[model samples]
Target chain A: MSDLSDERIREEAKKALREKGLKCVIGWSAEGTPTFASTEEEIDRLSFNRSCVNNLVPYLTYEIRSQRGKTRDGKDKVVVPVGVVVRGCDSKALLLLLNEKILARNEVFIIGVPCSGVVDPRAGGALFRKCVKCAMRNPVVFDVLASETVQEDEKDYSEVEAIERMSQEERWALWEEILGDCIRCHACKRSCPVCYCDECLLDPTDVAIKPDTTAEEKAHRPLWVERSVNVPENLVYHLARLPHLVGRCVDCGECERVCPRRLPLRLLTTKLEKDVKEIFDYEAAKEEGQKPLIAMSCMEDENGFIM
Target chain B: MSKSILRKDKVAEALSALGKQSVVYAPVKNKRGIVEYRELGKSASAAEIELDGKPDTPPKAIIFPQTEVLLTYRKDKDGKFEVTPARPDEREKVIFGVRPCDAIGIAVMDKVFCGGKFTDPYYKARREKVTIFSIACDGPMDSYCFCPSTGGSPAATEGSDVMMYDVGDSYYVEGVTEKGKKALEALKGQLGKPSPEQEGRKEAIVEKAKSGEGFTRKISAESIAKLDNSFDSKYWDDVARRCLSCGACTYYCPTCHCFDINDEKGGERVRTWDSCQFGIFTMHTSGHNPRAVRAQKLRNRYYHKFKYSKDNIGRYLCVGCGRCIALCPASLDITKAISEVK
Candidate 1:
């Protein structure tokens, strides 16, 4: 994909709506954040820059009911095709979504844009942790190429290796300090692109309870986790989310970016991503019919940690 | 009214002196480099008190914590259930270096938690035990501020015990309440009387602060008048399309006071900060939800800020601190949304 000028990208966004008949185009608004553009006038407000950091792929999920339009018929309701602007990382999220059968590849018209790297607002021009080690700066898949694909250097997993080298006690202490900062605000889970469960397993309502318990007692019962915000419970909540995102997380770093506490969540998720690469010899969102690493694992897996 | 002048060099001394008498919470940098309000004692730095702009986290947590245990329940040997209420910290504390908008945020929260017929005992206990020492903003901290638009000025003194104005080398402080007067007495000899020229300088500073800078966004009374009719408009669907429904905006907001009370392990009851943007915020025990759609949830945020808060409390819920604008991943600027109302 060739790098399209920010103006050219905006122009193409309008074209997608007018010519391609997309119900709406999702891109950066004049406010320098993700916006939905349905008309030419609204598309005129679309602009892109280094500050456009949000992965727009998450909005495609049904958790946000407004994004899914009304069905024409009772059962097989036809959804209007949605046009989305995707950076390098966002393109991969789309790929993973397509592989999971969550989204039909033809349902979305993608405008893939090549990138140098996005600026971290907190660090003021410094690349985000995920972008710093990004192996791909060009979209892996797209319908419309916004930029000519550019070559980029690959990143080594030194950060994950450093954490892997830590003693078990040292690692526990590190996680305790980090997760202690978590307020259980759920910002990280909510901002994730691949966390699309309609009712998350962590929700207390979804937990099974004894049949004899009353409604009030059912609400108060601790199934797997307590409502407390202690370090242990917070760790359970975060660590639980990592497995669900195992082969799906695009490492977009939206979770870390949106965290009010500024918890370095990428540290944990990236380790899982690296493990998937090492153990199963698989990288996420690379091809068309690719399955998740966990979905294709074998019984002869290494037991290095069992000792 | 007791008056005092606090020099820049003496800030540390004054804070340390105040700390000896009562706990003091000032903005200090955490290990992550984010400035948040922390207690002014062992391991905390008094020099890191951010006075130039709003701190990353507001001082509301001092009164209403992010998460608090309301009560601890246990069963006795006789198998009878017993509940013990959790007591709040009764020690007096001072909130130092709070910006005017955040100070107004405390005042707004007071209406919700303290003004109604039934007051939140937890919030009231903490609110009464704390003293607010607000630093009047000389101008908007950044381009996102719109305090004046919401009937609040940069130099507003709605919720402060002591209001301090920066005038050259020192701060011209005036005690606004009896509690402020008592606190000022501790710094009696350390302070000096301001000269007429210094008083004039303070007036000039307040005037400039009151006449806020040119803001990129504006929301007037007229624009919000017809905000109700726009509830069903397609504009909400468009905005909702891009909204990630993350709690960053509401959690970081200074005046958002919504909370959820739940039972933890050992039957301990706790209340934690919850956001309306979450899909399950309005989910009932019966599995019914009034605001099931994301559009309604998004609309409810704006309506609560502009319409519902005003009708119920006679004041807008938002203090225009701009945390929502600055932190939103989708750039869902409330100021832009408000201007587009009607």
Candidate 2:
């Protein structure tokens, strides 16, 4: 377990809320929910544990991703600064977000917690798949250390390897069954840090998950999803997401963890991670300002789709 | 009026026997270890019936599917169009091992889709043929159940045709309605006469549940009462800050029956599950939306569940089955949201 105490989390959050002049400090609640604290009393509810399952990085991008040039806090004239708590894997997402300029360095303060991989309470308290293969127990970046850093585990790709070894037909059947049960709730997409687009390119039928458009756009935008929620659409949605997160996904497994159907989402992301390592000789950057993976192009690229 | 005892071992026999006639749906654990309602078939039987606890998803989709085609239309070479309305199902169905909380949820959905100003023909057709066989939870099944708070007991019988109790090695069954009694006649050969001892055990369990004992999680009446004045409270923005607006909570909820109708390119009109949490659910054709912000969208769900549903239907929309609590990607507990509304 991390030596960082819940008391320390509350102390740091209180500092951010009071001293930083931020309206709220985003952190894990007592029940390990993604929550915010605007007051000292609310800060007291801040907690850190192996059960703090959600990656809080996505919450940061919601206001900034859509409705550009505006803060949701209408009453405040100045841009509001918020404090955020991020774990090791979560810090990686923050790094990618910063690299893409989706979030700016001056807009917020960060309180990083070095984590000893979160455990899945639903899976009988077993360590999460991402934690089992965790290469960094220490936060990649942070303003404060809430916990003592721990030893990291060697990366394991056995789950991905098992699927890779399966025959083409066998692989198809496995994914078919897993994807067949999808209900198109878009929980995975909405929770993902990288899937920040207001309009999904798959179907731009003017239906935005976030109300990002103006009244004119809402009225004039063509309404529709070209595909329905059948096996084909389910496959397209999930499979398209795998490649989109090739380098960006930090293997948080939030998608798999949150799937109501309990689909094996790890298989897709892990396999792509292995392939990205082999083909591009790359992993997502650990520092801000590094050019993101999809941004750079090279002659040695394994796939020729990008001429 | 018929009561019978089904041995633990004979459950498969009775269910398999029923499967030979009408469609049978019971709880089955998938390879992923998640329990869900699956149809009994050649490979499915009593050994596979998972009655330990409720499934993460309600069986609402069994009656109201996630996606359903209402009608199809096409153009002919003569420039004329033809539309064919989808047929309502006529198959008989038996749903077994439903938790009482979920049964109450179905009853609430009945109020929404089949009892309001207009009846949904699709929902009414399937609902009429389904015989609910609800199993009783002697105490709180887990940390999330609060059926009593929503005016439902651990063994609610409002929506269920039959109620079953686990008494040692056999099930003590009671038919609460005429439909439930008639359905039991099919299992006459498999059922045995209930003994006085079994009857007593079932009675004791039912009686203990009525007293509302041993539930760690409950929504106090005071908390629910506080919700009426909390519409403009700042507490909503605070709690909603963490919401991802995934719509998973509404999708998994048993009683959230909001649906959207869309016409396909081929002129087929389909109806699918919709949620107020989604930005498009309330979007007007004129590019206007009333519940546009994240906080507004999230707050609408709580109001619909607690205040509007109560004012309209005389009961809270929530049945306290806690599927939303258990399945939410973010830990937005509905019980906490309503009770602690600022």
Best candidate according to DockQ: 2
In candidate 2, what are the lDDT values of residues A63-90, reduced to their tens digit?
Answer: 4344346447755345567778888777
Per-residue lDDT over A145-249 for candidate 1, one digit per residue giving the tens place of the 0 to 100 score: 776676676765787789899999999999999999887667677678888766566643232233354788746654566656688788888888887877777
Clash pairs, candidate 1, are: A1-A147, A1-A148, A1-A149, A2-A147, A2-A148, A3-A147, A3-A148
TM-score of the second chain, cand. 1: 0.96
Candidate 1 residues lying further than 4 Å off, grouped into runs, are A1-20, A44-47, A62-74, A203-223, B214-216
> TM-score for every candidate vs. truth?
0.93, 0.93
- Candidate 2 wrong stretches, greater than 4 Å: A1-19, A63-77, A202-227, A304-307, B265-267
Residue-level error in angstroms, candidate 1, position B252: 1.7
TM-score of chain B of each: 0.96, 0.97
Clashes of 1: 7
